[model samples]
Target chain A: MNYFSSDFKLGILGGGQLGKMLLAETRKFDIQTYVLDPSDEAPCKIACNHFVQGSLMDFETVYNFGKQVDVLTFEIELVNLEALEKLENEGKKVYPSPKTLKLIQNKGIQKEFYIQNNIPTAPFEKFESLENLKSKIQNLKLPFIWKCTEFGYDGTGVKVVRAISDLENLPNVECIAEEMIAFKNELAVIVVRNVSGEVKTYPVVEMEFHPEANQVEYVICPARIDDKIAQKAQEIALQVSKKFNHVGLLAVEMFQTQNDEILVNEVAPRPHNSGHHTIEASYTSQFENHLRATLNLPLGNCDSKVAGIMVNLVGEENFSGPVVYENIEKIMAINGVTPHIYGKKETRPFRKMGHVTIVNEDMKIARKIAEEVKNSIRVISTK
Target chain B: MNYFSSDFKLGILGGGQLGKMLLAETRKFDIQTYVLDPSDEAPCKIACNHFVQGSLMDFETVYNFGKQVDVLTFEIELVNLEALEKLENEGKKVYPSPKTLKLIQNKGIQKEFYIQNNIPTAPFEKFESLENLKSKIQNLKLPFIWKCTEFGYDGTGVKVVRAISDLENLPNVECIAEEMIAFKNELAVIVVRNVSGEVKTYPVVEMEFHPEANQVEYVICPARIDDKIAQKAQEIALQVSKKFNHVGLLAVEMFQTQNDEILVNEVAPRPHNSGHHTIEASYTSQFENHLRATLNLPLGNCDSKVAGIMVNLVGEENFSGPVVYENIEKIMAINGVTPHIYGKKETRPFRKMGHVTIVNEDMKIARKIAEEVKNSIRVISTK
Candidate 1:
């Protein structure tokens, strides 16, 4: 297709930062793009040729938007899958497919898909309701994890089942109780594949968790682990992409067990935070590669040009108004420090306001600068 | 100044490719910008916060636009100087002030300024009209070059005079008659300075000319000339910037004679086409540094990380209508090939449709890929 500077319009669902960066590539290639998102202040709002502000989860909103473009893709999941499925039936192109999102959107179904594919994962039981789990508490083991099958993300929709009293406070909803397996470390492998069967995987990355929040606090690339283990993670992630017939990027979150085995955790179908380092480290940034794959263009080199460490900027506590990047200029003076502030305008505590990438020839130095970047700039509300 | 995600509105006079690249950095930093361009289909139309369409040379249009912006700057040099001077008098910040532009805008005036400032350049004589030049041709030698004083760019309004009859057919207008120096090569030095007096110069680049057109065919970074000669070029360019008290980027085009002498040709007080290689080759892209210097922010590293070669994508001689980058994918397959298509949907012969930048660790390899890029891609008319 004559996509570059042609009449072919590439439609992107979700006018957030991911879509914003994708639009940069499209702009570079002089490709026409139409972006749909609910927020008028979305980062993609300013860069796209056509900006449609509407609900991404609304059936009519998504269906109408999908029908107008030649090829349809999305930056964020959690859109109306039924609309995409209908669009697919009507001959519209939807990348990653609504079928793929359906299987991955629900945690219980995702785990079952792993089991069916012979993918190693922790054992889990899907309950019809949280009340059913309470009635069978005597028979069920204590100190398990309860995760809502759908609408679960970050640290939400998941709770620790410690005792009988803990079950009383739990919301009565369809969920999964999984046997919390002991893992050495949380890891991730980003696998990229084009429809032409050309596939490549980034090296395994280790995610250090926050002590209190149990969420990823830091992601270190080329994870410090046995080479064999890292290789196993990459191999498994590639197999998953092949099995799912996934096109574009698939970021497979994994676990490294005490036995030195790799286990599947979950997979994100679009560009994930785990691969943010690629912007500064890789010869082709994940943003650029994603565009390449979606456009069916030749993929660029994914090898690291320099060691890059990414520090995400979340809003500070007790701050809840207009966003400000304090000390942004200070870090711009430091070598290898590049800050990207998502033009959100508003900021609430724990909200992702921006990210700073530190790249250097020395990995050690890059990490040190990343830590300094994380400390110096506070994403706070200026009221 | 709370420029990031704030009410700071930056006004840019021209929304051409340079302004588009500059907007990329402004968007990265979340600095709001208002761009005015004659074309509604300008590359920066979607990138900036607000874009006004009006003739940049219109005094009222420029003056009105400047009043709405907190600080004003420009991409193209042919803006209304009176409006800029008026804005400066009214206490608005204007980088590369009207005074600096006055000295650099017209070729005849620029050459005179160099002489007055004790800068070394080939001696030239200014003429009120071309008819007057014919009358004075007896005293002047043959084989000299004639150039229009203003509005000349990219090989237009300039011609070689081998005989007095060459002037007979030429347009009777204000022009410059320069002594054709026996120069072996054309060179350029990009110097970036701020109001704070922090100055930095990118290494001199060699401009390879087309034998027929007498136009720059390729810009080779780290000019093939000796290190001493390159250093001399940079030093002389810095001296020129210092003399102008220039803020932002000043690209000094020069000529190197067979005796290894460097002569100032002219200067451009903006992010120039010559420095486009810095986007992929330099430690900090020229666009980024221009923003820093204009804001009086600390200067960035101007050193090149890789050798870069630039090939201009001019319109094919036989095609003039809709633009088509034929065989663009073929160049994409080559390593270090990055094609930048200026968002002009139309094409015309010898018109600068766009330019491709090839960067690599080795200058020889970059030059080779540049040749491949030049051969493989044709900016033709598809209509």
Candidate 2:
């Protein structure tokens, strides 16, 4: 198909920062794009050829948006799957097909699929509701992890249960309790697959969490791990991609147990925060690779020219109004620093406002600068 | 100035490919931008905050547009100088000040300024008209270069006068005759200066022209020359930047004479095609630095992460209709090859539809793939 500067159009669901970055690639290729977003102030509002302000979960909204484009893909995974299934039945192209999304959308189902495929993972038990798990508390372990089966994003639906009282304030919804294994490090690998079955994997990245907040503070590429462990992480990620037969990017989050064994944690079937550093470090950015995979175009090389590190810029606590990126200029003065603001007009505590990427030939230097960047810039509100 | 996600607006005069690329950086930082261009179908129509379709050379149109922006800059040099001067007089920030632009808007004045600054350049004589030059044809040297004083772009309004008949078809306008000098290579260096006087220079890039068309076919960075020659070119470029006292980017095109001396050819006061490869090769892209310099923000590192080469994609001689990039998929299959297709719907002979950038750690590999890219893709018409 003649996609560049042609009548062909690619439809994207969810117009947040991911869609905004994807638009940069589309603009680079001169490919036409149409975006559907729930917010009028979405960062992608201005960059796309057409933008529809509507709910992604609305059946008619998603179906209509899909019908107008030649090929359809999404940045967020919470779209109306029924509409996608209907469109696919009517001959429209929807990448990461509805069938694949079905198996990955619910946490209980995803974990079960891993176990069925002989994938190594922490042992888990599914409960119909939180109350059902509470009734069997006498039979369960003292410390475990509880996660909601559906509609959870970021850290919203997961928690550690050290005591029975922890379940009292939890919502009475479908849940899963898994044995919490002591791990040496948290790692992630992004695997990309094209419609033609060509696949590639990015290097493993280690996630460093803030001590108090327990949120991801830095994502370091090359993982600073043994070569064998990195290979194991990538191999498992590729196996997961093949079993799901998914098209586009699949970001597999994993854990390195105390004994150095790899365990599958979870997977996000889209561009994840783990790969954001690719924009400045890798040969082809994850956003561009996703676009290429969805379009069935030839995938680009995924090697890094230099070591890279990414730091998330979340809104600080105790402020919630029009946002201000304090000390942004100071950080800009630092070498090899690039900030990507999400164009969000307001900021609430812990809300994602933007991210900064630092890249250098020396991994140690890149990490040092990343810490300086993390300390210098604060996402706050004007209040 | 809170430019990121704030009320601040940046006004750009031309909405061509340069402005389109600049918009990518502005979008990265979430800086609001307004673009003015003569064509409604301009490449930048989709990416900017507000796109105004109007003449860049119209005094009232430019003046009114400048009134709505906090700081104004231009991608093309053919803007109305009076509007910029008026805006500056009224306290609006116009980068690459109108005074600097006045010295550069005309070829005759620009050459004179170079000589007055004691910069090394080829000997040249200015004339009021072509008829006047013809009257002194007996005294002038044969086989000199004839260039119109005003309004020349690309290869237009410039010619080689090898014989008297060569001047018959020339336009009757003010012109200059330059002594032709033997040069080993054509090179360029991009110098960036901020409003606060901070300056940085990109590495020198060598231009390889097409044997038959006399147009630049490839731009190789870190020009395959001795380190001392590269340093000389950079130093000369810096001197030109200082003499111009320009803010934002100044692309200085120069020549390496057979004696190993550098001579100033001319200067462009905005993002130039010579530095397009910086998008993927340099630590900070030229577009990002241009925006930072104009905003008086600190400049980024000017070092390169990898070697880069750029090849221009021009229309084939026989095509003139809806454009089609034939064999584009074949070229995309090559590693580190990226094509930037300008959104020009129609294809005409020699029209610059786009460019392809090839980057790698090995300059030899990059140059080899650049040739494969140049041979594989053809920008032809659909007829």
TM-score per candidate, in order? 0.95, 0.99
Q: How many residue pairs clash in each candidate?
A: 0, 0
Write model 2 residue lDDT over A236-335, tens digit each, in one string.
9999999999999999999999999999999988898999999999999999999999999999998998999999998999999999999999999999
Candidate 2: misplaced stretches above 4 Å?
Answer: A211-214, B211-214
Against the correct fold, how does model 2 do in TM-score?
0.99
Give the 10-residue window scoring lowest on summed lDDT in candidate 2 chain B. Answer: B208-217
Best by TM-score: 2
User: Model 2 over residues B335-383: C-alpha lDDT tens digits?
Assistant: 9988998899998988889999999999999988998998899999999
List runs of model 1 lying over 4 Å from the truth: A134-146, A158-171, A178-185, A209-216, A221-227, B211-215
